[model samples]
Target: MKKLLIAVAALAAFAAAPHSASAGPCGLPNQTTLWIDFADGSVPHWEMFAKPGVIGAAANFIYPPRLRAAGAKTVYFDLNFRNRIGTPSDPEDAATVVDRAHRLFDYAAASMDCPTPWIALNELFGAGTATPWSATNAQYRANVLAFVRTLAARGGRPFLLVNSKPYTGGEAGDWWREVGKVADIVREVYFPAPSIHKQGAVLGSRSMRQGLRRAAADFLAIGIPPSRLGIMLGFQTTPRTGGREGLQPANAWFRVAKLTALASKQVSGELGLATVWSWGWGAWSDGERDPDKAAAACVWLWARDTSLCDGPKAAGPGFNTSLTEAQITLPRSVQCMVGAQRIGQYDLARLTAMTRDRDVAYSALFARAAESERVRISSERILAAERNVILLRFGGSTSAYRGALARAGASEQVGRGVLADELRRAEIKRTFQVPQPSGTEIAAYYATYSAALARSVEATPAAPWLGGAKRGVALASIAPPQVFKLPTGRRTAVRWFDGIYRVRPLGAPKVLGSIPLAQASGPISIALKQFARTNAFQSWTITQQKAALRRARCARDELPHVAEVELASYLPFLAID
Candidate 1:
């Protein structure tokens, strides 16, 4: 009868194993592997899994015997000596890993209940780190294969823990298939508490189950059998402890445990799968909270093979489960949509004005190439000029300019209108009877605009007019019909053209020799006159722009939906002042 049972077991194992060129079954029974970190025997609620004849595995070597003693059927040690082997391809490191494996196997072999422990050689290729994994590294692959074969030779079970999922193609596929042959592979899955809560209870649970199912399918696709595959669920807390607020509140913990059990069953099917590892239950580090009594209760409810946990479930009175994904995606009402549309239009107009102002400032400061002298311009002409300036500033691409306006919630028409008003105001300033600029103002303007005058002369040599004052010319020529038309010894600003000049009757024209104007540079008198005109125009332009803005009508009614939008928004409630 014993021989027949052995034959039946062998048949079952064969049936569960995948018929592929990969690792055969590691023969680990379906069990929970709890990774406990505290060595001082602060169990962190390990006794919850201590039901009579409850077979389980533990990652840390210190507590397997104690778990067995506490009424567990049989507990196996999952030795975790991570990264002790430096440069896995190195001969010395590979030897060191094998030596440690031997010692661990010997230690587990001494325990009566766990003669052959499942030793995790080490976790490699963590997905959350900057380290990149390459299966193409032949030496590393050879080292891993050698390590697992060595353990199997010693009659010990070896498994590998990895957070990163491996792809199945070319050399990568070859590596996973090779590793899956001798050892079990477990993947770690973690979901932050906030993320779970954001989805609500039911969907969160469903999402987690889907994640596990997908992982199992991925491994299966790479020719790994369900019997040899395993999963490790992370329950860590605090960022320092490598967790994003894991399973906070009593109910969240209960919900995760319940869903995890269901997911495990679905993934493992009927086979005795490797193990479901529970990581991060240790309080060894600061900010790491150990599992509490409620957590232990939930684990007990899930682990025990009894009908005792039906009475006090996590879903009690006042627990809300009505919120769902469907409810979250309900379309907005027509009224609200209309209100938002109106608000958006209002915002666009404001943005258009702002963009226009910015373009105007940019053009004034840097885009001097397109600027030309114009004493005055009509509203339509000014509008076209502003639009042209904006287009030129944005690389002459209408689409780019439109895209910028759209991003700022502005329309091109409104921007042009605002700029037209600005130009009109500047033109209007020239008509003002402004007093002559002081000598101090002229000197300051000369210092600030000497470079500009040089560039202008270089660009248009014929217009030796350095901002309205023509060099080496009779003062009488500065009369009507010229760029700067002003009476003798009298100054006026040409705000529209950004030029201000005063006539200076320095006597009648005379043939002062055939000297080039470049060589016969004008005296300080011509330069000072140019400086005065520029200073007056600039100062008056600034004063008028401010006055126009102050005097401009800003109708609150322009934004019909502003109050409605504010009502629809969170801005009012968020104000601290």
Candidate 2:
């Protein structure tokens, strides 16, 4: 290894003649940087950095020329060193640091169109070693600063990494400010993966953002400008092997990953900091290995700027639930976010499904809202009692319930609100005031619509031995109502009672004409009951809901462009399937 290092140094010296560095691909001060650590020459997720959204990737240990050859723009050489080079009395120690940096720069320049300006000097201060303020580390501090300054003197932008804040007073703060003048000062801020996937509201993930903001504030308080500051987030493991449980159940992790990008973007835009850097894509220790790193990286890219790549598709509920290529538009409402709970286009789409006319949809929305309010007022105690029963169905595991809810695009609060609406609708049906049709009325109705009532069933051979034969089965032979709702010519995967064949509708269903009163009585009775309840529910609430709508003050804005988004953060708890 020593011989190899010496040979590389000799080669670097031969290539050290200064050449004008070419312009890098990334336009800085706006775009983020994806700094990944690889265990070996082989990059498992090479496709992640094969584009131009980020400021290019800062790689560790991987040969710069190899990465560039793979079509990745290698922008930074990530060097991990945690201690001073030599004793204070060693005159060659400071010179050694400069010489090493030059050799690395030359080696990187050999493969690039231009020399990379960025060099991430990672973890220069060891954990619990002499603090920046400690007198015991004066020489240590001087050597580190010399390394940073030397890199800067050669037109290189070196970012110094510290495990944590290493200062106690303004004196150390002054020192950091001096270092910041020449190089970026970054800190590693990591949270256990399990914490991000916790149950309930997104408080855990929100707390993570809050932690970042607070850390940034601390640096700013110590006189470091945001331009010279950065933070590194750790994505080190999957839940299975790491000592610290990583993000789990896939959906929750993806949600957090996307949110983390948004949160970091918010902080950077608000605070003017250098971009956040990502770490832990390598096959390192158990705590630093993530199997889903590729997907996570894609999500991060998509969240920052959609032009980079289509994000991972998440299967959930509501209109446009497929997120693989969802083009999100802002929720179109003046008061969308003004309520106790934010209203989204998802809710608007549900209302639209109920009715096509805007007025009718608004009426239905108000009716449901009023019913929800009434349920909350009159049946709060009952619902509260059912909460435990509902939890018991998930084996009392809040995490499982939350994970299930996340997959369904609902949080516990939304789930409970839906439950209340369901209960109110059920009660309305139970207490419906419609009188049953008289025997004469039933007979006349059956005679008029019998042909429309007849169910249609087209049969397809279930076994290969049947030679793929298909035939229309007699309507009378099959049971009623099962195939009644099947659309015309729509093939259904459902099997028949004997499982001998699958069925579909060969033609639109027609009423059973001239059927016996006995056979027609059951179908007629069911149809009447369903019609009465539906009519009564709509009419009964329309007038009262119109009055409520006047006071509701909902936005007059039209529905937003239909799109789907990951709902893990929004609906953290949903009923288990």
Best by TM-score: 2
CA lDDT of each candidate? 0.44, 0.51
* Candidate 2 whole-model C-alpha lDDT, 0 to 1: 0.51
Taking all chains together, the TM-score of candidate 1 against the true structure is 0.44
Mark the regions of model 2 whose C-alpha exceeds 4 Å error after superposition: 1-43, 56-71, 83-92, 111-113, 126-136, 199-201, 238-244, 286-289, 314-577
lDDT (10s digit) by residue, model 2, range 76-126: 645444433443233224446557666655544453345445667666553
List the candidates' TM-scores in order.
Answer: 0.44, 0.48
Query: What C-alpha lDDT, on a 0 to 100 scale, does residue 8 get in candidate 1?
Result: 24
Model 2, residue 399: distance off in Å is 60
- The parts of candidate 1 lying over 4 Å away from their true place are 1-42, 59-62, 73-80, 87-92, 111-113, 126-138, 240-248, 270-273, 290-297, 300-577
